[model samples]
Every structure is written in C-alpha cells, then in structure tokens.
Target: MKRIPLLSTAFIFLWFSTTAQDTLTLSRGQCEAIFLRENLSLIAGQLNIPMAEAEVKQASLWPNPQFTLDEINLWATRHQTGGKEVSPPIIGNWGRNQQYAVSLEQLIYTAGKRKKLMALQGVGVEKAQQYFNDLLRNLKLELRRQITELQYLQLSEQTFQTQLQSVNDLLSAYERQLEKGNIAAMQVTRLQSKQFELQKELHELKQQNNETQKELKQLLHLPPQTFLKLSSEQFERALTDETIPTYQALVSKASTNRPDYQLALLEKSYFEKSYFYERALRTPDITVNGRYDRNGSTMLNFVGFGASIDLPLFNKNQGNIRKAELGIQQAKMLSQQVLHNVETEVAASYKSLLNAHAFQKGIDPKYLQRLDHSLDAHTRNFLSKNINMLEYLDFLESYQQNKLSILDAARDLNNAVEEVNYASGTELIP
Candidate 1:
C-alpha cells in the first residue's frame, strides 16, 4: 500500500545487485589453476605448438614423383596404286600405331636443401613452444595480480559499508532528537549530509568492486553470473614472514628461471641455426631421371637413366644468406636487451617488497583497535554533552582512515610479495 521514495528504491536496488552476484571461494592456487585450465588466450597459445609441429612434418616430406608418356604416332598414306602403296607401307613390318615409352622421374637430391628446410621448420616449432611457455607465465602472473586486486577492493568496500551503516544509525538518532526539540534542526541536517556522503562513497566502492569482479570472471572464462569469493585469511597467512631474497639473488634467479628470457635465448639459437642453414643453401641441387622401353614383337627391352643439376651460376642465394645472418645478430641483441630488462625488473620488485615489508611492520593492529574504542567513547561522550561534536567527528574520521590505511598497507605488502615472486619467476606460496 505504501510506496518507497526514489532514493530509497535506488539504494535498495544497488544493494541487491551487489549482494546478488555470485561469490567464488578461492585461494591463490585455485585462482592460478582456473586461469590455466580455462583462459582462452592460453588455450589458443597452446594450440600453436601442435600447429607448428605439423608444419615440421610437412617440411620433412620429399617432393612427389613425376610420370610422363613419351610418344604415340599414327601414319596415313594415299597410294596411286593400292597394291604398291600397301607393299611400301608393309615394308615397315607389322606397323601398328607406333608407341614409344613411358618415363618417371623423382628428385634425387637438393644439395641439402631439404635438410635446411626441415631445420627451418624445426626452428619454427621451437619458437612456437617457447612462445607458449611465455604466454603461460604471463597468464599466471596476471591472474594472480587480478585476484589480489579484487581481494583488496572487496575489503575496502566492506569497510566503507560498515562505516556508512554507523553514520546512518547516528543520523537516524539525530533526526529523532530533532523531532523532540532536543537537538537543533541544523545539527540533524549536518548529520544527514554526512550520512549521504558516506553512502556516496560506499556506492563508488561497490562500483569498483563490480568492475574487478567482471574482470576476474573473464579471466576465469566464466559466465557473468559466476560468483567469486576470495580467501582473505589465506592472503593474510601468505604475508606472514615477509622475508625475501636479496636484489642480486633475485636477479640471478630471474635470469635462470624466467620463461620469457629463456624463450629469447631459444629464439637466438633458432636464428643462429637459420643463418647456417641458409649458408648451406649456396650448394647446387641435382635431379636424376630414369626410363624403360619394351617391344613385344621382337621381345626386346631397354632401360636408361639420366641426371641433371642446377649450375648455381647466377643465383647463389647470397641475399637470403645475408638476411639470415642479420637476423642472428638482431636476435642476439634482443637477447641481451631482455636480460637487462629482467635484471632491472627483479631489482625493482625486490625494492618494492622491502618497502612494503617496512610499511607493514610499522602498522600496529592493537593500536588501531584501541583507537577505534576511543573514538566510540568520544562519540558517546559527545552525545552526552561531555565533548564537542567537532571533536567526536574528527576522532571518528581519524579512526576510520587509520583502519583503512592499515588494511590497504596489508594488501600492498601482499601484492608486493607477489610482484617479487613474479619477477623472480617463482611462486610466493610454499
């Protein structure tokens, strides 16, 4: 019978939407597993390996043989005297329509060209495999990063909701007191305005959470309705010790362990092989042919074999050989560049981990709890006229901000550790 106000209806709708989303209960390992099993990009990248292998098999096959029919002759003659013409024609005894021979030829050799081609195809397969490995590493790291971000956002949103609820309750009490003429209408209006601001903040946080959830769903290759609830406790446990490898150690580990750098090394080797294979192509190719002939009338048979070869006088494949050599040089340069980048990344991530560790150590949970209790006491005192409203509000604001900062710092530390592990090409867990 009663209708809700527009703002109230809107708030209800927002709340229901936020709560109705599916929740995935996942740890970090579970998150990584889901991406490995489900992410479409990784799946597609994996398919490239088989595709390249098929190419290698195709390249290894020899060329098909060629078949030829040599000659078939038909004769026609007009005779002045039929008898004389027939006798002349009969001189080529038993002249059936003449048929000569059939021949077949297969390429015998290509001066190691087939070997070079197969080598090139083998390089292609190696490159594809290395690329797949690189993709796998990047995909796992991205999944971990996204899950961490979502967990942090959820925590932030929950804290904001709690603060908003507290503010709303206080505003409702103020409204009641104002109706009884025990509080000024201006005071009630100020409290109501604060409540509205908190609601706005809560709405913004929820929107951010929704966006992150959508990204996680996409990463997991799940439908939009799929729920994701992360294990915050597990994350907290993961951040317990905060001990990390030194910068030099991290660099060394990354150089040895990072798949991207290893892939680059493999690519360089492939190019080196390609350059040599191209140089080997300067040799000429030889082709051999064979044929057989038979005449049933005389019971005579003959066999013959012949060969041909390319001189390589004009085109020595000089341009292709030079290009392949240049490619080798370029690959080496790129390998060096990637090594430098990996070292720099490892150092940077190590520093970030150290800083995060120090920042987290500076946070005291008990101190925050005490401050929360004090802020609550101050609010009660303000209601009883023992303290001013400004002091009470300031204390509440400071307490809430401190709580948020601590949670944020914790999440940052966890993320920093993840970064260190990612850079060093290792797992943070275990």
Candidate 2:
C-alpha cells in the first residue's frame, strides 16, 4: 500500500476532526479512517450492540418482587354501641386495628428459564454485532466507489471548463469580427450554439457531482453544503496484484468473513435456543408469598408464607414453541440462500473485474497526455487561419471524448476492485 501524504494526514485529523468547512480535501485512506471513526451510520450501528447487550442484561435479571398492601380502609367506621362515644382510629393503633394487611410475592424461575433467556439474548447481541460489521463493510465499499467517481468527475469537469473558457474567448473575438463585417453572423451563431451545448452538458455533470458529494457528506457527517475535493492521487495508484484469487478461495473466505453469513447462522442458533425457552415456559413459574395481617388471625401478628403455580391445563406455550421451531428452519434456509447468493456475486464480480483490468491495460496514458498537449497548438493554429476550423473542431472534440473515456476506464477499474472486495467479503484489492 502507498503511504498517505503528510498533508492529507494533517487535514484528516485537523479539518475533519469536526464538521468540515466550505471545502475539504482528503486522500482515500484519510477519508476511510475518518469514516470508521466518525460516520453517523457506523456510530448508530455500534450503539446498537450495547443496546442488545442491555437486552441480555434485562433477560438475566430476576423479576422484581411484587409488594401488596391490601385491606387498607380509607376511613374508619365508628361502631356506636348503646350510644357510647366512638371515634375513628388514629395512626397510633395501626397494629391493633383490622385496617391494613401487607404481603410480598416473588416469581421464582423454574427449569432454568432465566439462564435460557439470557442465552437467547446473548445470541441477539451477537447478531447485533454482526449486523454492525456488515454495515461497516457495505459503507466502506460505497466510500471507495464514491471516491473514484468524484475523482473522475473532477478531472472531466476541469477539462470541459477549460475548453469552455477557450470557446468563450473565441466567440468574443468572432463577434468583434462580425461587427467589422469580417466574419458572418451565421458563423458566430453556430459558435454560440456549440458553446450552449457544452454548457448544458457541463451543468448536468455538475448536478451529478453534487449528488455524489452529498451522499458522501452524509456518511462523513459533514455540513450538507460543504465542498468535497476528492483527491485523485489514490485513484491514480496502479493496481499491484500479480494475480486474482481463485473462486473457491474467495467463496471460502466469504463464508468465514461475511457478517451476513455469520448473522444468519446466529439467527438459526437463536431460534434453537428460543425453542428451548418456549418449552421451558410450559413449566409455569412459581410465586412464593409472605404476608402479615394486623388482627385477622387468632394468633397475634399473624405471619404466613405461601406458594402458587399456574397449572399447565390449557396454555403450555404450544404456539410459541411451534413458531420457534419454524423460525429455526427459516433461518437455516436463509443462511443457505445467502451462501448461494455470495457465490454467484463473487463469480460475477470476478468476471467484471477481469474485463476492467484488460481494458485499463490496453490504454497508454502518457501517449494520451502528449496528444492532449497538441490540442492547444491545434486550436491556436485554427484561430490564426493556419488550419481549417472543421479540422480543429474535430480534433478538439475527439480529445475531449478520449480524455473522458480514459477517466471512465480508471473509474471502471477502481469500481470493479471495490465490487469484488465487497462480494468476496475480503480486501482483495489491497
């Protein structure tokens, strides 16, 4: 791998440490590092793991003891016997009066239900972590694709703007010539139409560039209107792999590394555990009770301990057990389906990568650069009447089109590498 430039490192830590300003320039490595640290979606994904763990904690906890305060009369009823004076009881005679009874109940787990529930919730946490990893993987792929696209768009836009500037200058000069009766008005009109066409195309590409940048900014959590200056240096780096990995190797690595596959396996395990938990529910929880009454029992300060259990006469969690069993089969089928999909995607992306590599290998970049250099001389010659306008325009258009093609080829190579890495669930490009 190439080392990141010192300036890019500084900018990544300094400018990108917070919300970006009007313009931000970063190398691919810097951008990816910042993304790992600061991307909002990744942050949300990470947060979910803790939440799942919290659910596990909740599952392992014993149910809170239920406290009861019964037979608490709001007002005392005075019993007037033989017209004797009678009064409502005050707070001091709480024990002697028959006004209040208190009890406490605790749900005791049977059949290791708490442990089984905790185990089930543990699987849920694993699933959350796997989902987070999958999200990070996907975003990394998207980031690389965005970086390559923006680099290509920047180069293409620069070339078009430069040509547009030159055409505007020529149009101004030709307008002056027409006023002096040296050039026809119809010729100036043709030049204006060509300029308008170029402007329209440029505008459309600009909108596309903005849309890509906006999506990238959302990932980085940057201010929406901030300008993204994607560095072309990383895109220009040559592919260093001598050969691609075999299909079997990629598929095997994907089975091990792909979070989606692992997540599916975890889902299957979770459902299996859930089936156990549901079956455990058939053994109804026991509720033990301890109570104290003021004066109801013949014995003073009566204290009692009792227990209760729901008889499994009708509902025995039969429906939930069936659902859990069905869930296991569903999860198994889905895992297998994911394996098939990953294999197909890896094979297809490998084929596409091969085509992109062959196309890029055929192009000679330095030769194109020299040819592009000759374009300025050609344009100047045409303006000086040393070359015909038709020939000059033809060569200029070809130059523009060829440069766009070269940039597109680079983009294709970069995109293909990212696609393959994503599908294979490994960083094959690096």
Candidate 3:
C-alpha cells in the first residue's frame, strides 16, 4: 500500500473519535444535557433572563438631577442730558453681574410607583425563565420522538431485507425447477415479478432510513454526514414499561410545573402592577429649585431655594389609568385561556396514550412468532414443489407486512407516552 501521510492518519483518528463521541448512546439525562448545551434555540432562550434582569435594574434607578446657573448685571446705566425729567435708573445697579449655582434634587416619593414598576420587572424576569424552561422541555420531547422513529425504521428495514433474501432464494429454486420441467414458465415469471416488487420495496425503505438519519442529525445539530448509530437496547429500555400518572395527578402537576401557565400568571401580575403604577400618576411629582446671584459693584451675593409641583388641574392621566386597568382584565382572561388549553391538551394526550397501549397489548408476540415459523415452512415447501409459487409469495408478503405493523405500533406507543409526559410536565425520561 502507498504510504499514508502522518497528518492524514492523525486526522482520520481524530475524526473517528469526534464522530464517535457525538454518536451519543443517550440516556434520558444525557439527552437533557445535550439540549441544554447544544440546542441553539434553548441557548438563545437563556439570554432573555439577563435581558429581563437588566430591565429590573433599570426600573429601580432614580432619575438624574437637574442643574441651573444665572448671572445678573448691577453697574449698567443710561444717561439722558435733555430739558426733560430723567428716569431714576435705566438698568439695575444693585444686582449681581455674574453668579454660579448648582443644586441636586432627588425624588422624594412617587406614591409607591417605583415599587410597582419593580414588581412589574420581577414578573418580566419570571416570564423569561418560564419560557426558557418550556422550550427545553419541548425540544427534549421532540428529540425523543425522532429517535424512537429512527429505531422503528431501522428495525423495519432489517425485516424487509430478510424477507427479500428469502424471496430471492425461493425464486432461484423455482428457476431451477423450471429447468427440470417441474414448473411452468409462467410460474417462474410470476415468482420473478414478486421478487422484483420486494426488491423495490426494500429500496424504498433504505431511502426512508437515510432520510430519517438526516432528520435525527439535524435535530441533534450535528454534521449531516456524521456516522451515528443508536443502541436499540438502550432505546427500548428508555421507553419500555413506563408507569403513567393518573389524569388528576397529571393535571395537578401541570398546574404547578407547566411553564406556559406560570408565564400567564406572571403576565397577569405584571399588568396588575402596571395598573397600580399608572394610578399612582394621579399624584403629582415635586421639582425643587435653588439659585445664587452676585452683583459686580458691591460683590454682594444672594441665595434662595424654592419648590415647584405640577397641579393635576388639566390632565389627571385618566385615559392611561383606564387603559392599564383594562390591561389587567385582559391578562386575567388570557390566564384562564391558558389554563383551559393545558387541561385540554393533557386530556387528549392521555387518551392517546391509553389507546396506543391498548393496541400494543392486543398484539400477541407468541402468535406472531408461530406465524413466522409457519410462513418459513411454507416458503421451503414451495421451493421443494410441495406448494405453489403464488402461495409462497402471499405468505412471505403477509408475514413481512405484519411484522412491520407490529414495529410501527410499538413506536407509536412510545411516542404517545412521550407526549403525555410532555403535556403533563413530567420528567419521564430522566
């Protein structure tokens, strides 16, 4: 063999390690960690927490103080030398020519407006937190669903391949029988046609398997060409024999643990705080002013302080306060709506789980195993001229179809349980 570059060999080894590490023979906890660390949307959702915290900080800060300076002239005068009487003084000569003044005024109170604003900010932070948690839960559920689907598809593909091989063997036997004049030409042609159909179906399943892998990779945010293989035993153990919670218990759990409901409650509180803050606007804010003046001629300085407060005489913020009150009402309505939706979803998902479980129970593994053996016997009999080609093909097709259906049913049951867990805010996986 030609010498492989040292760098190339190292790269190959590194690639294998990286890909293998990413393969993730995932447990429920491992799936949760991957979502927390790698899922882009969930990571982006975390930024909202800091953003809301900044808003709270902003709400707690006081307003900047205002400053003012003034100058007065004290030695300027105009003289009129005419036959008419002169004015006493054209300009003031007793006031300061220049003055420097600075004053700091802090808001004394705003009738609990600041406290209300801070409360609203707290609600915002809570809402952000709830949203992030909800996103994490939803992403994990979807990932589980896809993983389960891929497992089912892989199993189905194997079943189809095995069936295809058996059919090929039977077809070969039939051709040999035709050569020996033990079978009609038409019978051999029919067997060939059936084998062709099975091959076509096998090809389709392979294509589907490829597509499923691509989807799984996309969900995991891994490179498209990554060589990932799931451990079937691990997957089966993850979902097998799960004990579902009671409906009442699930509803209670959702009320406490579901993030969307918590978010709605936070929003209602935020709007209520806003209402109170707006109502506090009915009280006017006070502005205090202080000034100092100096005269150039006598170097005299004057200082004075005064307070100014706006009268709510013209506008008393009636419209804005009314709007805020309405907002509180709206938030309450929305909270009710969210509660109803959660209850409905929990009921529906639980029902689905029950139906899927029933279907799974209805399937008899022993009966299927016996039927599979029978189909194999029939196939062999057809090859040995004890049965016809048509009967062999029919038995093979039926056996494969039944096996595929069983696999699909099993997968559906797993997905339904995941759905129930997700809707009820239960940690079924981890």
Candidate 4:
C-alpha cells in the first residue's frame, strides 16, 4: 500500500491559524520585556526605589531654623506695659511706639548623629533596590515556568487532536460497516468510547491551557481578550554538556548576585547604624538662639545670644539604644540564615538541572521523527483493514505515551534550567 502523508500536522497548523482572537506570538525575551514594562506588580515594586531615594534626600537635609516673635504690642498702654518706655527709639516710628521681640533658634546635631542617620537611610535605599531586584527574580522565574507549561500543554494538545481525528474517522467508517452488518456492534461501541475518552482528555488539556494562558497574559499585561502563543523557536532547545560549576563557586556567585542575600547584609548594616544613631541620641542636641528686643530688655533694641540643651537627667534614649543592639543581633542571625539557605538552594537546583539535562540528552530527535512516521503507517494499515481495531488502538495509546513523555521531559528540562537561574539569582542557564 502506498504511504499516506501526515494530515494531522496540517490540521494542527490550521487549528491555530483559525483561532478566534488575534494571536500574539511572543518569544521569551518579548514576554519578559512586556512583563517589566507593564506588569502592575513590577510597576509598583519600581516605585519603592524612588521612595527610598526620597528618604535619602530627606535625611541629607538639615533641620529648619525656627523663628519666633513674642511680646508684641499692637496698641501701647501704660498699665499693660507695667511702666512707660524709658528709652528713645530710632529708625523712625518702627521702634518708637511698637514693642516686639524676635528670636531664631537652630538645632545643632552632636556626635555626628545627623550624618550617621543619613548613612542609615542610605542603606535603606540600597535595601529597597535589592528588594526590587529580588521581586523581579521571583516573578521572572514564575513567568518562565508558566511559559514552559503552556508550551508543553500546546504540544500535548497537538498529540491528542491528531489521535482524536484518527479515532473519529475510524468511528465513522465502523458505523457505516455496522449499518451494512459487516462489523460487530461491539466494535462500533468501542470506537465511540475511545472517541469520548479522547474528547475528555482534550477538554482537560484545553482547561489547563486556559489557566496557563490567563496567567501568562497577566504577566505580559496583555488584554484579557487577546490570545497569546509562544514562537516555535527554541521550544526544544538543547543544552551543551558544559562543565557545571563547583558547589563552592556557585555559592560564591549566589552570594554576590542574589539580591535577597545582599538585602540581608544591608539589613545588618542598617541595624548596626541604627545602634550608633541611638547611642548618639544619648547626647542631646543644642538649640542656639539669637534674639533682638524692643523695650523688653534692660536696654532698648538689645541683641543677645543663648544656647539650650536637654540635661539628660532622665530618658536618655537607653531603651532605644538597647533595642537597636538587639536588632543588630537579630539581623546578624537572619543574614547568616539567608546565606545558608542560598547555598543549599543553589546546590539543590544545580543538581536538579544536571539530572534534567542528562535525561533530555537521551531523547534522540531522529528517533522521535521515526516514531511519527510509524504512527502514520500504522494508522494507514488500520484503515485498510490490514491491522485489527485492538492492535491499532494499542499502538495509538503507546504512541501517545511516548510523545507525551518526550514533551514532559522537555518541559522538565526547561523548568529545571529556570530553577537554576532562579536559585543562583542570575541567568546561569541561558
């Protein structure tokens, strides 16, 4: 018998071409670009950087000098004044009948408290930046995994759809044969059952695809009505057998690249600075003042200078200083824990990727192509009555299992690569 071409391939292409909404085919890079540009969470996360910067700006500023006006007399009276003015006033009528006192006070920080507080806020800014980076790392990993899942589901759908078309065609032929009494009713019933099962599985696949697509769309900030599809390029990209870095080397890279780890260090520094600032608070700041008086001092138009400070007789910031010291210890412990977790996570992810990559390398592409041809040939033989219904169905099931296994393996390898990148806090797999 002459061999038939694989019609299922064309059918799969047609299915996507005729989808209802406009399909937005994107590469992973495009998806990430849109995610960074449009995702609401990322946009909100970015604002934190500027907000931290604003705090630094505030910290770098000096306290405003306070000006006060006191003892002003809009209307002069002898009884209100307790006595008549004794000194002659100059500068025309400005100081002649008017009585007012003015003073300006400026706070002077002691022990470099202001500069130390600024340094603390500067650390806060750094922490905010790292916090944003960590957020990006997490979300980007999620995005990549979702993309891989969607690709797997799509490939799986093609397998099921092709099998389904074959079953439907066979069922139609079997029904015609049953009407002519050339085949058993049981045979027709079995074919219908198989069709139903295929439809059910296909439905489930569609449902899964729906969910993954929904999440992918949200990550890219696309409209809900828009359809999304990944470009076919690199869907089954192979990784070379390059040497995996040593565990210690990976840990070193992670310590430097991991934003969360850096944030932990910043947390320690911030608290250390807080401790210093708190201790500095034990010394009260001085408020120096200069004042000019009109008829309110021993001499008319008198000018004076004075300084005031808290005596620290009580409430010497001892409680805050103690809390800051405790905070330093807490931050130190937390940072150490973060370092441990980073190292362990990198080790686990590295091993997982290596295993997945090895498994993927074992799947021969030419063998898969041959398997496809065998299925087409078997399907033709079944149609021509050269193979029995039971044999054909069994072969179909095995074919699907093998194809799905390949898809699963590819998906796992992709996800494992993403895991390594995520754990290392860098794109180590690209």
lDDT of 4 by residue, 174-203 (tens): 899899999899988988999999999999
Backbone clash pairs in model 4 (N, Cα, C under 3 Å; residues 3+ apart or in different chains), count: 0
Error (Å) of candidate 4 at residue 303 is 1.1
**Rank by lDDT, descending?**
4, 2, 3, 1
Query: Per-candidate TM vs. native?
Result: 0.83, 0.83, 0.80, 0.91
Q: Could you give candidate 1's per-residue lDDT for residues 1-430 as a string of tens digits?
A: 1222322454335335655555446667766665666678877788898899999899788888898876533543444334343222223565433335667887754557677778878878877877887787776767777787778777777766766766677787888888899978888777777777777877887787788888888887766876677777544433544455567777877888788888788777777777777777787656677876543224335578898878888998899888878888888899899999998888888788778877887777587678667856776786778976677667667766887787778777777877788888876434
The residue-by-residue lDDT of candidate 2 on 363-386, one tens digit each, is 886867786678778868868989
Clashing pairs in 3: 72-96, 96-294, 96-295
lDDT of 3 by residue, 1-430 (tens): 1222322454345446655454534434444444455556765678889999999999898787776544433233343224332223325742223334445455545688777888888889998889988987888788888778767767777787777777788778778878999878998788778778877887887787788778666666666656556656433333333566678988999888899999888888877887888888888887776766443223345566788788899899999888888888888999999999999999999898888877877787586688668877887787677977667777877888798788877888878878888988876434
Error of 4 at 425 (Å): 0.8
Please estimate how well model 1 matches the true structure, expressed as its whole-model Cα lDDT.
Answer: 0.72
Instruction: Supply candidate 1's per-residue lDDT for 300.
Output: 38
Task: Using TM-score, rank the candidates from best to worst.
Answer: 4, 1, 2, 3
Better of 1 and 4 by lDDT: 4
How many clashes (backbone N, Cα, C below 3 Å) per candidate? 6, 0, 3, 0
Off by over 4 Å in 1: 1-23, 70-95, 110-112, 240-242, 293-302, 371-376, 428-430
Give per-residue lDDT, candidate 4, residue 133.
93
